[model samples]
Target: MEHRHLGHSGLMISEVTYGNWLTHGELVDGDRATACVRAALDAGITTFDTADVYAQGAAEELLGTALAGERRSALVIASKVCLPTGSGPNDRGLSRKHIVESCEASLRRLRTDYLDLYQAHRFDETTPLEETLIAFDDLVRQGKVLYLGVSEWTAPQIDAALTLVKDLGLRSRIVSNQPQYNMLWRVIEPEIVPLCLREGIGQLAFQPLAQGVLSGKYRPGQEPPAGSRATAGGRAPTFIGRVLGTPLLERVQDLVPLAADHGMSAAQLAIAWVLAQPGVSSVVAGATRPEQVTENAAAAGRPLDEAARKKVDEVLGDLVDRDPAKTAQMMAVKPAWRTA
Candidate 1:
């Protein structure tokens, strides 16, 4: 229910954003997806995030249907571009051609004429940064996208974009970043966080539960729970590799009593941990059920105190991924996004 400003901008977003990455119109039924979105709204979540590449665009359509009749002025809707939507070379990247076309398509799919925030899904090294920035500026000037953001971009990439915008006298600049951040994944901590803080960009974190690994449902030695993401067939399983071992599971188990002590679930604890980090504007949590949505929304605005955070650090000693080089990969672009 608590809202935070997206970076230094005037726009505000709910602390816990409802995101349908692999759930809506993909892993779950349409009814379930709608119910989860309703649950998020009932819990006072006004921010909804989806990507064009999620479920091949079905996710955006499902989210649009779910939020249909809600007050658009009272909500903050966000979507992303720069992903391969088809086989054509123009189907992806942050090029001017793709960005403009993708924004129009996203608006149609989201059932909204203007996006509260439009983000680059990932950096496109092949495309000239000027082309992408100009395209984003064009959208901003046309009143299609209110704010700009980038996901999975490194510190240098962000800095370079900001510098270019300043040098070229462009109006559009990055306000937020969407990165995979959670209890087990601290890859953005060392370099990206400092740079973003300095650059006035806030973190709209994704996978705050470590793709359900921190949900405490995945036992160390036991088989992944039936129908769980780890057991399901999709790209969600791909990111679950980092935390599937017994060592991490055992540490998670140790945190259970800690969660009980705090009167929260393991999932809530995971969410709280991410929100406590500096520069985090919101934690985008995914849900398959209505109850899960409500449960996660409760983690908003309530972060652990210094003592509790220190205890968590001791429990997860040396397990965090802090390497700056691991911030991004070439999944979206052939050779990674940062050209500098």
Candidate 2:
């Protein structure tokens, strides 16, 4: 796998990272998860991304077990904070108490002493930005976290935090932002990408296939493939529903042949498209099977040339979701404020 520097930081990550956001303990069993992780390592993937809130923390434990006994220095294990991990009022958000405590908890769950990168999963509007950044800075200074990042944060939110870090003279600066980016989702290109390029924050794009929609497995009018994410029996991620429209599916079909012309599958073409974007350091792909991991890892060093990228845009014409407001919209309503 090809590795690239994360933002301006000296740390380098594999271009195709293995992320267990929806799979792992939630969708797949322990043996299957371990096999998938093995596939990633065999494919030379050195980075693994997981969040504290995923599968109620079971994902981390599973990843920890799967990665046991490897040379830790050869891996970049990343996890996030600022999500509700419990029912207690203090169990959520980016407050200092939560940030510090969550780091400790994550360290234990991941079976590691220090995180390669710790990120604020979302902008905590309720907590003072200074408190959050300072707390993350504390983790770096204490040697518990090596670098810092954010996910789904808008350009303005990221800018505010970076400014606070400079003014406060924190030890660590935000090096990356994790966002839903794909051929079908170009929201970050307009605002976040420009600001991050200026600020030296690289993007670790998740959902690079638009939650599997861009893989061309979902036909325009056919039922979603059995056991696919869309047909998985549970509360599916809303993004999957958003892009399953017939128009979008038809557009995705147009890219299938384009992928063939490049000697790649539809999914690899989708991942290569994200990597072709400016300031994107890596693409976080999740899988339920070993071959899926190998298939995605193949996209690492295979970059789509200018003409192929243009063909993608031409085929996906006007169907992309480029609204820069969606990032803010994601954080607008705090889940803590909701009643089930």
Which one is best on lDDT? 2
**lDDT of candidate 1 vs native?**
0.87
Which 10 consecutive residues of model 1 have the lowest summed lDDT?
A: 330-339
Report every candidate's CA lDDT.
0.87, 0.89
Candidate 1 per-residue C-alpha lDDT over 1-340 given as tens digits, one digit per residue, 9 for 90 to 100: 8999998888999999999998877687578889999999999999999989998889999999999999999999999999899899899999999999998988999999899999999999999998899999999999999999999999899989999999999987899999988776777889999999988899999988877878888887899889888877677676565457777778888888888788899999989888889999999999888999999999887769888888888988877666667777523222111112
Q: Give the Å shift of residue 63 in candidate 1.
A: 0.4
* TM-score of candidate 2 against the unseen true structure: 0.95
